[model samples]
Target chain A: MARVNNWQLGREMSYWYPEERPNKQFAAVFDINKCIACQTCTLACKTTWTSGKGQEYMLWNNVETKPYGFYPLSWDLKLLEMLDGQEWSEDGGRYEGRTIFESAPAGERVLGWRPEDEDYSYPNVGEDDCAGQVDGGASIQMPHMAWFYYLARICNHCTYPACLSACPRGSIYKRPEDGIVLVDQGRCRGYQECVRGCPYKKVFYNAMTGTSEKCIGCFPKIEQGLQPQCFVNCIGKIRLAGWISKPGEERPDNPIDYLVRIKKIALPLFPQFGLEPNVYYIPPIHVPTSFTRQMFGPGVDAAIEAYKAAGAEGDDDLTGLLGLFGSTEEVLARWKRSGDTITGYNDKGEEAVSVPLREPVSIRPSYDKLYQITRVNCP
Target chain B: MKKTIPKIVLLAFAILVAYASCGGRTVSLSEVVVVPDQQITLDPTDGAWYAHPYHPAKLILQDMVEPRLLEPSTVEVEVTAMTDGKQIAFRLEWVDDSQNDLPGPQAFIDGCAIQLPTEESVSIPAPQMGEEHKAVDIAFWRADWQAIVDGRADEITSIYPNATVDHYPFDAESLKKDPDAKRRMEQRYAPARRLGNNRSGPRKVPVEDLRAEGPGTLSPAKTVSTGKGVRTEKGWSVVISRPVPGFLSKEKSSNIAFAIWQGANRETGARKMRTGWIPLVIRGAENE
Candidate 1:
């Protein structure tokens, strides 16, 4: 395992590249409460990237309904089942379980997993389905225990990406500039280690070229100061994309940095994996608190509380940060509220986007009895 | 004595017929396929392999749990190995129904590989591309690369004529000035063609040397090798040759393994036919 010091996981874990952090890490905050499972972001990412042959079932950005749905059909469930049980030690501030690296038996480079091609053939087999009781009676009481919420997923671009670590040929790498993990096609021999090592199963195999491919974090678009297609095309306005500074680096004006670090409303998914996934999420508040804590980490309560406070107190900075979602095509380095408008600026302090905190609205024309177009008042 | 001699002759004839029926499938033994001490071309039909014995190694379906491929090899590979003291070569002939030399967007290329452990002391590496702590050097020859060497590069139009493009950005004259303009254009517009270009070596030499420490660890080695393949009416005849320092002593033998990837059946990775370790022997001058 990679040598480590000063990590959230106190123990010396698996071997990973020594961290010489990128100037800015690609990060995202997806509000699970706001996601509607519309799959608009999925299609947007598909049309932009993974729409080629051998990529028919790959969803770079997929919103799977939690507690029931999974893109690779129980990707998380299988990992969790394999790990058996996990415990969080508050005093040590670390997880007590076998990480993917620690779990791999001898003679195997990875934790020995190979999903059948059929497993990938169905990315949304159980979409929108929830695990619960099904009663035949007229009086139904299925709501007491059953619950489902949308979990929008993309490449985490982790600080210690298992995919990058597990690639024997060193084909997968995290960019020193933006921290976006990528598979160098020229180097990849389609060993499928990235596909196996990724606990999230985001890295996929391309049988056609006999290599592995994953999200590039839209680095080309990002270089142009543009938000990724998924973030920009989000119909639910749930995704916020920005650079997150490493721990101890303070940039409160950075929307993602503030939400993820300062206010602490956004928490990383599966912190127990010990990869320090860059993508953060405001855990779904409606789900069972225990389930959310298990999935998100011990910070679930604080995150939910901070999120509620931001909306209740109408904190302009927090509201302005939330308003930045899907508001522009350009990447925003910093954001602040100015009266009714939330203005976003690039790293150079040039205004990139400005959106009204609340969109201006006018009365709609009255509809006719025929449910057809009818102008009643005025344009 | 005359009656006994006739019976002996009949018995010998029956045994020969049985061995011929099995198509020269050699038994698992310390088989030594001799290599002459003369320079020889890599042409499979160059009459050079005639001096060596054809030991057909039985290949079975790789029914590993990872891929779970159930299809069996339709024909046994008639193998003849030889070396010219400086370089070792192997000739493999298999009966393939179709010439699946082109790997398109959703296709796999028919190919074969010969695996030998880098260090003789490391015990024969795993049949499935070696294992951790046991490394093997592989010489892989793809049918697609052979087609390119044969001056017949497969195009998208060859597979599907109906699929046509109206216009491409590379058609603009400004981008054509770069030395690698055509290559850059193909890489962006045609992914399948890009893969073929990336995988294949330069024009005359098609085979490349690869090393694997374990499954999913196959990587290109710094040194490349040479291989050639010819498609006949019923099958393919492939010859893979690599330069070796010298032949091993009779006391020391190298373990050899083979894997075949059939393009028509979507066979790749762990999904291919393979043979177990065959103690490869290079005949010494005293034995010859």
Candidate 2:
């Protein structure tokens, strides 16, 4: 096991892959509170990619209701149960038990668990089910009818992706340019190590082709300096895309850095897994604190506080950056809002997207009232 | 009593010699003068295979250690091969205590496959389902598809009594539309298994003719081939036959391989048990 610093974990943890950071890591911060599960992002991703045979049930981008929903049906619960009783020391900031690699059974590189085909037959079997009413010591409790929130998910593209580490033939690779993880279709032998090793179950088995496939992070779009389809077509405008610089080399002007590093309002998902997932999320404030803390880490409280503070105080820079989410398809390295327009700059400080703070509004008389005047007298 | 003891001893000696001659897990492709009248069917007792010289190909089954999935509990497969002038056939059988023939929810049926090089141009493709530039053609046989071929009902409601449907859009007569409605209805209930035996048709067939250049490159071929599997009490028996026009050429030897998948073990994709390439040499008419 190799020990490496993971800012998301707030401590060094074990990983199988070496520490080779990317120049400009592609990252996103999703505001969970803003997501309405309109599924516009899901359709956008489906139409762009994953619309082939054997991929009928695949959702490269998905939004499931939290507290009772999972795409692969209990993917997280299974991993948690396998690693049950594993302890984490807050003071020491280290995990005591085995990670996906350390706990691998004899003769295995990573713990292998395969969900049955039926597990994937229905991608939205329990999209919005409610959590069981366990009133005892459970910290996060909600009223009988109104407890669930939408959780949009994609491949984390982790700093230490278990999928990449588990591939025996080295078919799965993480790019050095922007740290996008992809499966080399030509080299994969359909050995689903990446599928079995992924804790989130984002990597999928294409039975028709007899190989594994995963979220490509829209690298073609990313390479051209444009945001992913999911980010662009978000009906709720909940996603912000930019580069996440390495720790100790903080680029404060970077939109992703400002939210994840400077303000620390967006937290990486399941940091305890210790993969340093690049996607960060602003936890849903309405959900129970204990549940949010367990899902996001101990930083949940602080993250929620910082987010609320930004919105309440009208911090224009932070608010302006937030408004830039889904502002335009072009990827923004840095952005700020001035007056009625939000201007986005690329990595080289070249102007990319200049969208209005709000679209132009028009007021016209009602049809009945408009009949009283013609085009010449409409004004 | 004395005469009976001699007879038993002689029988035992003959059996031992046959086992030694065949080697532990290796079989030879024997050329046959007559292809059985009952050909192109998955029958283990077909007379053509019995009349041909047979070798016991032993199989050492193991877990897919690469991705490190579940270890295979069963350890052996019995293999035999025979070829007429027109088609080549292989029959594989193994001992499986459980008969997992239904591909139900969370259930995987038994399956096996045969792989051969598409072209004899380059070195034999990597056994790991062939790599790019070194293409290998594979014919996969699954129990679920076989059951449909055998005219067995494969509806989930029939397979699992407890599986019930409260209501479906197609069930409502008011919502029915002609021409494509029945197919759309079948798609709703039996999304993966509706085509039945016709499922093997290349363009619309469920069982596809696939070729792989390397690990991740398994792709469907433009045309489909013939293969079938059957579930037996002990395990599964399968036959995969194809016409290789120049298989018996005097000059060159051939490489062929097989893979087995136990769906009950959650074996699919890269999680399978396979054998390395086995040389197949055919005797020419001159030798005969």
Candidate 3:
């Protein structure tokens, strides 16, 4: 074991491999407050990469309602039970608990479990299921009748991937150029240790191929300077694909670094697990702290407060960056706010997306001069 | 006698490891005799196997030293080998409560393998997958592979009987209706087969020839071996047939090893029950 720094944990933790970060890391952010759970991203990913045999059940990207939903039944609840007393030293500071690697069984690399075939049968078992209770005829207010939020998920492409460490054959690899984790089809003997080791249950076994496979992070598109299919086709505009930097190496102009580091409006999901997950989520503002804190770590209440200030409290930089989500097909590398408009640039310093802090509304004239047609319903 | 294997999975390495002497454990010679029986057949259920006496080879944890082992489901295997001077065949039997023939992500396959030194020498390499430059040739027999070769498991439907499927676009209806659809589907979906991952490929023979230099260096050899497995009332009885090892080809007396993995216990590579080099002496004509 090697002692490596996990910025999310605010301390060094035990990891199988020595700390060797890539030059650039693939990352994304999901706005839970904006997601409507249409599953367009899921189907887009399915048709693009996983339409082949043995891939019928794989959804590289999925949206599940939090507190009662999981792709493979209780993927989180089981590990949470195993970890037991998970707590943080402060509200948004150091995590004072065991990570999956620290709490792993003796001789095991990670704290994980393999799901049965039946567990993956229901991809959306608890779709839109409510959690908290409410009395009859509850008023429509901030604390809603029942709390539920859409959580979009994908491979975190962790800095210290559990799947990579569990393979006895060393078949799984994390690409140093893009930090994308992949399975070497040739070297893998189909032991399925990667399947049993990933805490998020993202890696899947292809029974037909008899090898494990996982999200490629769409490196092909990334290399071509375009966003992933799911990120580009998200109809809800609740997702953004970009590069993330370390805590001290925070780039204020990078959209991901700006939201995750500068403004701290977006926090990693289950940071206590300590994989240094790249994908960040903006917790829903209305959810109870008791539930959200454990899911997103001690940063939940603070992140939600900062997220609220993005729009209602007039934080222009944050309000501008949130508007850049799903704004273009190009992967955003650098972003900046100019007065009322937010402009995002690609890696090559070319302008990609420019959006206003608030959308503009226009009403047509009651009568047209050229066509001579009168509007039926005029305000 | 009611056989009850102690649930304590603490495998004492000094007793069973080939290099235990290097670790300050005194070595005691354990031998299993291999006689020259002309009527040896590669049929595990041959009733002829009852004629020869079974040699008990107690198993130890493979690769990992003690305190590192979680549990080993298989404790021992009964071995009996016969040779016609040209080829060698050995029958391995063990007791298992569950017969695991399908190797899915959640399920593993029951298997047994016999390993032999590639060269003839008095000193043998480390028994835990051998050391670098000291290659050990191995022949492995898997229940799942045997099931496929026996026409028991044919395709995806065979592994997962109740798996509901709408359709796979690559698996065109025209192709499924073809006479050799199984071969074609095996070619398409099973990428391992296409890339020549002999471990996961469609099995023409029940056993594959493999060579290993170290723990993670197991690869397919250039030769072919044959085997058969039959799930009995107690467990599995498997017969593996292959050319005599170079060490055994030159000398009548040589050393060999045995390893078995219990799928139900989630055992596989580097996590198996194995034995150290057990001395084998072929019986002479005078003795026969």
Candidate 4:
């Protein structure tokens, strides 16, 4: 029998006990289908917070078109190629599980590829090289069918953030109270240790101050009884911000509930990395289930079913899903209750949800005092 | 006959001797002029002496003589000149608290010249040897420029009675790098670090005050008019103020994407900055 590592279990799990938890575990849920990729949120955030010097290269918020999308130039594919390896499965899929090879035969790998390789390549439309030509009535070279969806992303403020673990200096910490992750500006030495460790690569160094900065989750506004600026400012009304449960509470019968728990439109981004990211997404309905499962997790089917069942009996359309799960109160309640297990009942009276709770974790942010010099005239 | 001649000669010689003695030159030896060494004594009772108006002369001496020895051969001397003129120089040599030779006090002249002044009263150069004596005579020198100005060099010289050399001993290497000395100089002369006139701390001026036509600068009635091109939740509708002219062309649009973020409390009417960006693409207009 495998030895039960209760300590390890304790190290990995976190729960939202309504009476004990500090502020609800607030999160923003986004439906990929509704996102128009306008980048208004990026500009809004840029003008508000990141317009300062040292933040020139920073996008605390960004939206990238997927299938061939990434910032820092192909960051995702490059990291993926590095972590996994050259062999495609004989079964015609890009990956089987997660096996990374040390080295492969010359033809087996895409040779001479690098992360910095695309600095001069124009892969995306409207980029530097292709800008005015689009307006000059140029013929379309790429078909529209190859177009992919865009995902606007920021710090998820994860339940088990890999960024927190990668910091050797203990500068990264999460608030046990609100579950917001932050880097202590004073303690951070701009080591880039956390940057290398985080699978998401959200931690960034500010060139001006020589320290790492990341999303603060809009905690100050949240504390003042307001939703996050990102959630509140979503022009598409596609983002919802509220609390989630510790996996064992009563579930709601709303659209958000259907998307998160029932229909599972809103599923965790990548659970196998095991960081347990809090920001969930509603699976793109047009995508294949295999791809969806790979993007979300093994449990995408159950979540989708839960979403379909939340609406009135006769409705089968997307609007019904939106109508049933869109309300904040029911969705928030269901999230608060769904901790270690799914919190709603089904017609069969069996366990209807699978919300996994493993261990409790915390992140504490710190600050440094800096001196400024000013000139004065004597009297 | 011989006896009679001898008697006549003796009588003549005796008469000549008596005449010479009676007419002797009446000379008296010049009264032996004794200056009595000009009995110089430093008037300890003087107000100036008690007030220490004159800089104290410090003698830095090296202890070459052992106490157990009957007599020591050599002593190294370092003299620090502290007085601001008005003082003279003198050296008193003695052996075992006994005076051997005392040089008369000399006044400093000619702008405290480095070379010793050679007069009946002369100022000796620093580190000069005293009158040689056995049993190692200790010497004391006074080169007070101030005493020389006061014409009290005679009195200042008397302070040393059976004088013993005093040394200002220190590690030359350590003094060269004295941290405390550096700190003292810095404290006395360096400038202090301070913030602005409002030294309490850095003041954060409101963001609106920093920008022209911002919230703080606008009148309440004009608030709605100032934020025109910029989108706010309540006063605006989603309009393509500027459209990408040929968005559908093969060439990429300079503005290929449009992103939106909603303001919090859009209904109740609070003007706050948006938090996050959600990307949107332009599909052909519904009318088109």
> DockQ, per-model, please?
0.11, 0.12, 0.36, 0.01
Share of real contacts kept by model 1?
0.06
Choose 1 or 3, whichever is better by lDDT. Answer: 3
Give me the TM-scores of chain B across the candidates. 0.79, 0.73, 0.80, 0.14
Give the TM-score (0 to 1) of chain B in model 4. 0.14
> How much does candidate 4 score in TM-score?
0.40
lDDT of 3 by residue, A304-329 (tens): 88888677888888888889998899
Scored by DockQ, the top model is: 3
Clashing pairs in 3: none
Which whole-number lDDT from 0 to 100 does residue A46 have in model 4?
A: 62
lDDT of 3 at A81: 89
Cα lDDT for residue A148, candidate 3: 93
In candidate 2 chain A, where is summed lDDT lowest over 10 consecutive residues?
A: A137-146
lDDT of 1 by residue, A16-113 (tens): 56766677888888998899988899888876776554465578888888777777777887777777457878752677876766666543344535
Candidate 1 per-residue lDDT, tens place, B1-288, comes to 344557779877765664445443432223435455577568987776665566666788776533345758644676777776678888888888877765442356788888878764257677777888788888988887786677753443444445464434555677777748855754553343365534523355668788888765777686557978888676888899887633254456667888787877766666688887777876644245
For model 3, the stretches where C-alpha displacement exceeds 4 angstroms are A363-379, B1-29, B37-40, B63-69, B120-122, B173-190, B250-252, B285-288
Rank order by DockQ, top first? 3, 2, 1, 4
Off by over 4 Å in 1: A5-12, A90-92, A132-146, A338-341, A356-379, B1-33, B37-80, B83-88, B91-138, B142-186, B189-239, B242-288
Query: Per-model TM-score of chain A alone?
Result: 0.88, 0.87, 0.94, 0.63
> How many clashing pairs in candidate 2?
14
lDDT of candidate 4 over B1-288, digit per residue (tens): 344667768766765554234323111111101111212123222222121111111222212211011222212111111111122111111111211111121111110101111122122211221111201011111122222223422221233444232311222244558867644432221111011111011122100001012111211111100000111232211111111123212222111111111111110001111111111122221123
